[model samples]
Target: MTDVPRAVDRLDDLVSLDTGEIDRTIFSDQEIFDLEMKNIFGRAWLFLCHDTQIPKRGDFFEAPMGSDNVLVVRQRDGSIRAFLNTCSHRGNAVCRAEEGNVRNFMCTYHGWTFGLDGELVGVPGKSIFYKDKLDLSKHPLRKVAQLDTYRGFVFATFDETAPPLEDYLGATGRLGLDMIAERGDMEAVPGVQKFTVHTNWKFTVDNVFDYYHPQITHMSAFSVGLIPAPPDDFVEGGAKSDTGANLEVPFLPTDLHNFVVVGEYGHAISGPDQESLEVTAGTEPFAWRHKPEVEARLGRHGGRVAGHPHIFPSTWVTTNAQLSLRVPRSPDVTEIWWFSFRDRNSSADEQAASLDSQIHFFGPAGMLEQEDGENWAQSTLQTKGLKSREIPQLLKMGLGTSEVVKEDGLAFMDAPINEHAQLWTYHAWREWLRNPSWEELRERTIPRDRY
Candidate 1:
């Protein structure tokens, strides 16, 4: 781990946190939330729409970064660039459409226009309005500090000093995106499903790692066969209601395993091993990259990672052809966007079927997200209470017991479904809130044998 002054002083309080347990205050504190906007969202390489969404010049899409929004455009030179959507002239939004093809953006208020590359291209009466003295170049849209793509997923950052996209992503983060990229000839499914949840953004992020919640939160999905449900006699810790009994219930199948890849700059990936066929029940639906030699490539270690993978701050890559972005709006509100994709090799019917399942599982009408959102919303409300803010959250499941196996940039733990990944994220979050130098941030969060 890197030595970081900004975060080190708060280490004890931060690490003391138990997985699945948290002080309600974190969800509603204005100061903490504001710091998160700067330390986490400001510096992270947040996912924008896929390159396919803006394949032609003049095509653009609007994406959120914390409370701010950016316009990602396809340039005439066959490249992509992004800039803040706010106008350089008077802070008015320069573009209002969610996505469309346009030669230039004309601000509704003052008619200021900007080119695809965010260059100021036209003003209604440039010479007459400003005596030809105003420099359009100087007032061009404020370009994002960095923009990059991996396997077609575009991303941008606001911090000029942030590390290059690849370095910041690390192997863990790369693997997360690669999971979707490895699927055959993938592309975004066209429309992005947007919905708002009355909860803190972090709830959506941490929930991705929560295998423990599905049975309870998404019982509807389980009952309807959207997800496989355990038999009546099955139990995790035990059949008893006590924590010790529940701890002994044996929730996960003995063979099911999890791969947790903790990386530099607070990026991490947590999921079931992909190579394992048990997850697919022998369906083998996805055409994973290097399938001809994936077993050889991943070896015995990586052959089984088949669970959800999350990029720090706001991106989630699921085993199915889907990606989701959790955009923070305010301390108690979050906007989630879903990008569903399909294997280009599949027939039209298969693609449609796949999309149907995706919609039923995660979108606005999805069974799973609704249940999860309720708890999140309620949790956020609890945080607003003064007394609730002082109580500590807990993440003790599978703690102090499981030995983490570290290999090939991934941190492995054989423990049954637990809160290790969620706990690790909060620890990383605290590090970011301290706002250390990039070098220190990286140093403090490098991969380790155990975390």
Candidate 2:
């Protein structure tokens, strides 16, 4: 394995929190990407398969953790464990299938078998060729340093020194998951809609907190009524087309308030308030937030966050009962996995409707995702150009203007549609790339009084 690059020496030059500008090269640099796989993905608690995906003994689901793949297995003892998928003997994959129930995994390259608990169980020529000298206990598939679940979502980390899962999540991250968990008896839908986008993973991640691009990037969805359109009076911003003429652009209503919550380790929630969304999309879509019990749990501020919640690095929790994992395959390629959720107790019609909305809104065939993917691909493509890459990407929408308000163990901001959350994410990203201690990282990512 390659050593983690000393990228922190130029972190400030790469991402300037003071100016809200970021070096484009960070998106395309191979060295930087390698550093991320080691320093960020290797350390942070990454979401794996949900508990619902593997409930029975011997059931397993494959998930990506940086450049490595892991098998999350339900053990015979009614517990879960995860380990690297590679065979210990020859480094070949022990399991070929993506997910299934099996008594044991036997490597195809060499019939070295492993039990559901990831213990080496059998070796074809052990007695004859090896003379029974090989130690199976010491040669079991390498296990993850830590594994835990929150609300049903399984997460794992390769860094044993990493904080406990809950501390890692903090208030903002917990609220993000709570947004989905509080809905009802939620469970992962049958299939995970996955596809690849030729874009830097960071582009997909930062876009979660972006509310400014929708009116323009997803105009097709709005035109087709897939996404609710801005009211007639809401037309305020304009963008210059290739012809240099100004094209009318619809913007969210000026008075619409956006709620932003930033927490340690780069977790954030940002977008229009639930009241603002209801004003435009109607309250029926967000009726769950209004429930007395749910509202009490989400609290006043969290109850209003009708937007995307991002757990630093890659996990994104969408308001529409879906969680997306932006798996970085390369500097310019990312595999997008959509895990849709539904209330198991709901009527079949309601469950079908939920899946339909999840599919149409943000998956391989989703209209909004298709539009966003184009922009992200193009943005990443520009970073490779000698001249274009020199230009700094801007996130100056609401820089240094919003005051963070602390309430009920949460630090948040209420403002018009802005890029505070995106900027916050980049700031946290810079700190994370430095590979500081957990205590240092927490201090660095703590929400500032102002942005």
Candidate 3:
């Protein structure tokens, strides 16, 4: 087996956009994972909790930022603040609960209490043990460098120099959120469904843009009528013909067009075009995108992006009115968190139906996720093998064939089912691991005339 090159010396060899091949070591290497935590997760703006999750003052939700856990708390004045969950004194988590309305966080370890704004307010033995030498104000929980929200979705970054939330999101990212926000007065559902997947987080992320897998990986879904089967003509044209002796599964039709939007900082939206989807489904599933106001906001191209939009590192915006965070725990372990949303004004029955769909689609209990988890787990496992890790993973479908059209602040393409977005993501990933300046990173990731 070939030995892997040092990360710093061979960043370009890790992922080659020109050849659409990625090194497998990136998925399982401990040193590379550590670098990612510092260069990507540490510096990038990470999604925390939705603003609606902690609406009331003193409400707090524990969220993971890289390896550290943080408490996203609502201030007394209705502002939001987030700080490390660890107590300043003893490094013990001050708040134990995942979420709740807390008066103040008092460390059970040493009785060091902190205010909602992350101010160190009380120390139990300050006067006796320290003889009043310890200052409460000197040791507040370490706060995040920057925190902001976009359309009620909260994000924070440890890098103080990271761009503002809007600037970071850019047009493609904003359009992804807008797809959900413009649906109505949307708010997060009460509970966030979270589960562990024994896979590298990158697999879960790139899978968002994979249109090729559903037809094969989700054949069981089609067999059960969970997803609409392709038209008879499409099946005849592409499916393997089996007499009564064998199982016949139709493939994703080749003629169907996919809309791919790739943006700065690894953000991308890739899947079937809304028009192509209507052609297959024989009904309009995305009528909301056609609404005058929503169309005006989404623009011509954005309105047709009936696909998964992924922000750099880990946020995934789904068309089913949900956001998923693929949190990287280690090289081989990832935590998937699903935050389902609903319009505040929707009817009870509509809300119930939405919740049911959300529950049955991609969370812990969801069949699709269960199927996907197994594949990702096995894929991650193979990356650890001596021979397998030496192999380059191929992503060559529709690679050099697509022309990128720049319009309305989006660099996109309408092509057949392809890996353009996936390739684009890896390209961006390589640049990010380089830890360039924000301007330099943007320059490196800027979409070219052809993807």
* Model 3: lDDT of residue 203: 98
Give the candidate number with the greatest lDDT: 2
When summed lDDT is taken over every stretch of 10 residues in candidate 2, the lowest stretch is: 246-255
Model 2 segments more than 4 A misplaced: 1-6, 239-247
- Backbone collision tally, model 2: 1
Q: Write the per-residue lDDT of candidate 2 for residues 1-451, one digit (tens) a residue.
A: 9875466678888887789899999899998899899999999999998899998999999999999999999999999999999999889999989999999999999899999988999999899999999889999999999999999999999999999999999889999999899999989998888999999999999899888888778888888998888866575756778998766765746776899999999999999988888777998889877889999998887888899999888999998989999999999999999999999899999999988888999998899999899999999999999999999999988888899999888999989888888888888888988899999999999888998
Whole-model lDDT per candidate: 0.77, 0.91, 0.89
Task: Please give the lDDT score at residue 176 for candidate 1.
Answer: 78
Clashes of each: 27, 1, 0
lDDT of 1: 0.77
Q: State the lDDT at 101 in candidate 3.
A: 99
TM-score against native, each model: 0.90, 0.96, 0.96
1 versus 3: better lDDT goes to: 3
